[model samples]
Target: MDLLKTPAFAAHVESLLKEHHTPGVSIAIVHDDTFSSAAFGKSVISSDAGSEERDCTPDTLFDIASCSKSLTAAAVALLVEDDVNFPNVKWDSKMSDLLPEDFVLEKDEYTRDVTIEDILSHRSGLPSHDSVYMGTKAKRPDTAKSITRKLRHLPLAKPIRSSHMYCNLMFTVATHLIETLTDKTFSEFLQERIFAPLNLTSTFLQPSSVPPADRDSRLACGYSYRESTSTYHAIPVFDTPEDQGAGSIITSVNDYIVYVHALMTHAPPFTQAIQKALVTPRFALPEYNDDRERLQSSTLIGLGWEIFYYRGHRVVQHDGSISGLTSTHFFLPARNFAAVILCNGDAGYPAVAALVRELIDQTLGVEPSQRLDWPEIFTRGRGVRGEAESEDADGEQKNEEEKAPSSIDTAGAKDMAELTLADQPEKERGSEEKYIPPPFPTSDLPLDRFTGEYHHAGYDSFVVGVRASPEGGEALFIDAADRCMGFGIALEFVCRAEAGGDASSPSPSEVKFLAYLTDVDECETEILEAVFVVDGDDRTDAGGKIGKARRLGINLDEDIEGLIWFERV
Candidate 1:
């Protein structure tokens, strides 16, 4: 079969590299189970001293970040086929039951209730609250244990199956659970169950596990942009055995294609059941409006993937990012087309999505649809419809005025009083008008009330800690292993009033949490309305009942809105 190449594929890749100032990129396209790839720029940027340009190749390895979740999900499916009791198994299953007693749940309650489905669907309610990995102490295994122990004290943001909230803790917990069940670590289970069977040799969870001979030759160095110097710099790569199932997998475009093929073809019982489960929109994210024409009105979140409906086609895809690198892989099963793009630098996901859409259109022989240009459209509309205009007429041969006089100001007037007296507001006769600020009650409930540890029922290891700011206020902090990554590392909250302007009415509150990258880039933010609902004890707390925190919206940002939920806990 002739694989149709996009007319702008090469030029688009070049333009993205230049525009984003990316150091290196690796891309692949899959059609009819066959694949083709291209690479550009240098995997490692040059420093003050001269260095060889490290060109990206099709075989270049990239840290796939959260793309690892799909692989983990696939492994779970294999276990399900092995007659592992998926539904009946409690999340808090003793590590000693499956592994060693030393591997225990920190929060007895969390470990007790969490389940395999909870981890896979990201409904574990655990907040992505670890910042220790960014620090020097990230190498310790106790780091993972510390995070796990805190889960018992933390409160759930939502009840089980209430909504989706992406939790790294859940994935790690699932990894441990898999080891307990199969007598293997997460990497070992994946290698035995999924990778080896699919023949995906280049794919693995730990980067160090890959042969050293292939490191410099096939591995792409991760990079981050230095806005100060206007250049890219290499960022250090570190691994956490705990976060392995969540975001630690590293692989190449060619190997990821094999995984995507497995997803498309449904290699077995996993092929049919998991694919069906993944494409079903499990939750509704906030409506996202973006500059791209292809993304408007079409983005939704599946189990571990993103569901996009562009021009009447269903596209399932996901994007991954760590500190220095960003990666994206998307496929349209209906059109039998797939594209994987991995960048060594923080080039972002929008470009990758646009490229995939373009490729799909080219391969399917469909004309690309024009995006609505808001600025141009508004400009032209104003010209044709005309802005509010004024007319001046004399007795004979009165000509229309094209422009209004600048000296004649209309500030503070309710209507065009100069044009018509009836349309204007009545002026007070000899009385001065005073402007009064609206009265509203601000909550005096100390920020400390909001400052506490939060636990997710679905994830035993994840904990969110809100601390009093040294500046004399409260700031949110995330505790993953035993360390704290400062506020805005994983999630942030914005307080909004209940009724438009009634802040003093003691009105019910609403908070929106903005999830950001370690470098402080916004990923996917979620908004939860504070509603009074019955809790298990039939009492309302500051956080609200976990059951009511449903996913009311999604994907407002370029990143996929993972699991999002809200509970007082």
Candidate 2:
């Protein structure tokens, strides 16, 4: 079949392999129900000439972490269709009702109240308290039970349906619910209903269950960065049967394409209901970057899929990341085009998404006016090369600096001039006083008193430390997992307290902390803020509960929050 190849495909394949420093990649393009798939580079790098790089093939199996969410969602759709009793199912179904009485969450109120829809939409009010899984010696069931038990004590960050917080626990709950509803495990339910019907024989819930030789033949080994060594190394894939609904699916690019096609076309029993669920925008994700254009429009998130605007068209997609593997599947329903890229390295998905958009546009002859020139945009525009010029320089150096900063400065100055003109003299500028700063209130507790280790049952371990600033007032720091995760200037804290406080009896010692970090190229800054509350309660014989504190909110300036919790040692 002589289907037109994208002009950028070869170049993109080569560039992605180089830019991400990946050893190998397997890519698939499905257009108009026809399929084309290929693998590039090598699966493994070798030190000796006798060893050859393993070639990625169409059948290369990847650990498609969250991509399995879509499959799980589809399976639920099938079950809903099979039995009218399904949608009537409530969020509060008991695991004991499905399995044994000792099953987890036997006593939690919230756990009893959570439903199937809530689980699918990730609105079960479950925070991503992942430490139980990461640090537990308990096998899958025990780990899952511990997580459910922990949820009984964990406070909800937001009201149910108030917002979307991507969490794995909700899906786990959904898996249990499905088992209860169908009297079958989630994997069995999926196999009997969705996978088997679609003829996706190569896809399955467990990786280890496959034959060792077959696993060696198709499995893509995962990888992660060694911060100390400044190199990449293999990372073990999480082995758990219970996580099948959450993150335990393994499939080849060809098999995943079948799933993506089913999604785009609404094939089989899923045709009506699945289509409705996939396009609905559950919540608005925070602005991805300062590129105001992308941030302004709300992207719709379906049960497990994210719908993005590309070339004025809605595209449904999702990316999966597990240890060393990253996979992206995006489909343009309007254009009848879809792309899947799977790699055995920690490659970023944004690039693959962009490339897929480009391929779809080229194939369909739909020109995208606002397409970002990526690596270049990251390099020259963001000053990622570290070749940015200083303010003071000689003639030759001045010219070099002027080449980049001059353009940015000109644009910024123009925007500032427009703002200034709009605010000018017809309004009596001198009469308008500058915004006055608020004064900090006197407090008896020394800064050191508030400086101590604090722990949240669900969130993570954090330390409140203070250092004397040259400006006189102390700089407060909140360290989580040895990383200086947050800080706040004294003035900012005082202002927040004054603006939003109990006027009669606000605690002067408690203040909010906001931390801002500049990107690697210093072209952008990201902020994460949290309210810091001091506890007056005394330590107990049991692990002392300092005063009650909650993460009131979080506004991450970046897409990747890295807001991980520490496990209890």
Candidate 3:
């Protein structure tokens, strides 16, 4: 007998989504060789009373986030299989040999010695170089190369292969390798190699690449929440074609399971040779990065998977989150079971993992979880995830903090630049004053001089451009593009300020600025701040460019003491 009746399971899923304020969810399961799928809730919902919203269906598209790495790893394995006669690509192949000849990691020799195996398991010693690929204005076509060129200057977070730090850029480099070795764009190669062979027409890297007509009907809307009102607002899908290998692939749970089944059965593209590499453990971490409560001493990471013990049972899986979406792909391969859970909301982050585990445990007749408690944990004032992560390790309490359908609720809910700006408020006939330019910019330093490309010894480059002040006159109109992780920053003002240090030696800095969500045009502002110090003559050029005009040191988080410094090219 099924542990959960179909109707009961659907009801439970809907309950979870509403309780946690996640609008939509999709789950697919392969139990003892039979395939099944369930979806519930609205793909799009509004805090606004009169707004149009939409429902999610079995075919709804989702931004699978880091789960894309599994597909990317599979692509690499196929290349290895295909290269039997040519320059053979092996797991132990040193990355120095694979990198484009022109690229150099000048100071980090340990990095050059990193093997293909290292990258697959997130052991490249590179921490997430978020500022590199996230906010930069660099053309998407040049992102991989620019990141490669800038990589030499970044210092490793840990000794190479010594520990796991969840570096996405390493995968970016791997995708670059795939492109170079195959002489094809990553997209083209993936289409010809993985998607076609698996007959997965719905899976793709970019949302824009999908037909507008089809996307309108199926793509699930992502969302974010504000604590004050406890309301959920829709977020747009990501615009991340630049970091394709790292985190941009989008697909539906239904389509994703087809790929999952192929891997399970060792189907075609995932041959026995590739399966060996795919399942073999590469790097091990102490505990699950996201879930601290579930302690797995032997958490070994595979080429594109995470192998850990759940209830003393071996389970292989991986989880991904960016902006509005969170997803997990997990299963007990030895038991011939697998499941995928995708939620389209930032608020859904913590619950996805738990739901996957509980469902599997109940199906397999294993010890059931005592309490999923997503609402008790993530609901506003109940101790949001951010608060939990920051809580004292000794134990304490705190709390705080999307998508589609099945028998669950289906909600109802567009483009690039217009969507990002949010509100799209038309100019009322009487408001000409809104267009007036401000006089005199903010900041004690010469603001015009900061515009240029800047490089950090251990991260990607940032381009500084000038814009008009949004709030008022006398504030500098400045926009600094972070090329590392595509984080959003809306230029507001530049000013002289100091934090820490006594009156005798106040640190010079720029005022706190707003970072926007890349996916949503009218994103809810989190009020995150960054403090940057500009330096000039004292900096040297490791970057191949000359006459660059800026030196910036930015502090992203308030609690951590680490500061990232960048020199103008």
TM-score top scorer: 3
Least lDDT summed over 10 consecutive residues: which range in candidate 1? 386-395
* The best candidate in terms of lDDT: 3
When summed lDDT is taken over every stretch of 10 residues in candidate 2, the lowest stretch is: 386-395
lDDT of 3 by residue, 431-492 (tens): 22121112124444344545667666545455555555433443332232323233334333
For model 1, the local distance difference test gives 0.52
lDDT of 1 by residue, 1-569 (tens): 33323555566577767766577788888787777887777776655434445778778888888777777766666665554565434323333344334333444554555555665665555444443232224323433344444455444555555655566665565566666666777778888777888788898787787788776567776665544445555553545465666678888888888788778877643567678767676554444232443343544556567676776778787777765677877788887777788887654444454456666666767654554333333323221211001101100111222121233222212121112222222221111321111111222323333334333332322333444432344444433323222112323343432433233333344434433222221111122122221223222244542222212221112112343232445
Please give each candidate's TM-score.
Answer: 0.62, 0.63, 0.75
- Superposed on all Cα atoms, model 2 deviates from the true structure by an RMSD in Å of 14.7
- In TM-score terms, candidate 2 sits at 0.63
Candidate numbers sorted by TM-score from highest down:
3, 2, 1
lDDT by residue (tens digit), candidate 2, 271-357? 856667656766555433433224224455577777767557777777776546777777888878887887877644444544565
After superposition, the stretches of candidate 1 with alpha carbons farther than 4 Å from their true spots are: 1-8, 49-52, 84-114, 132-149, 293-298, 369-569
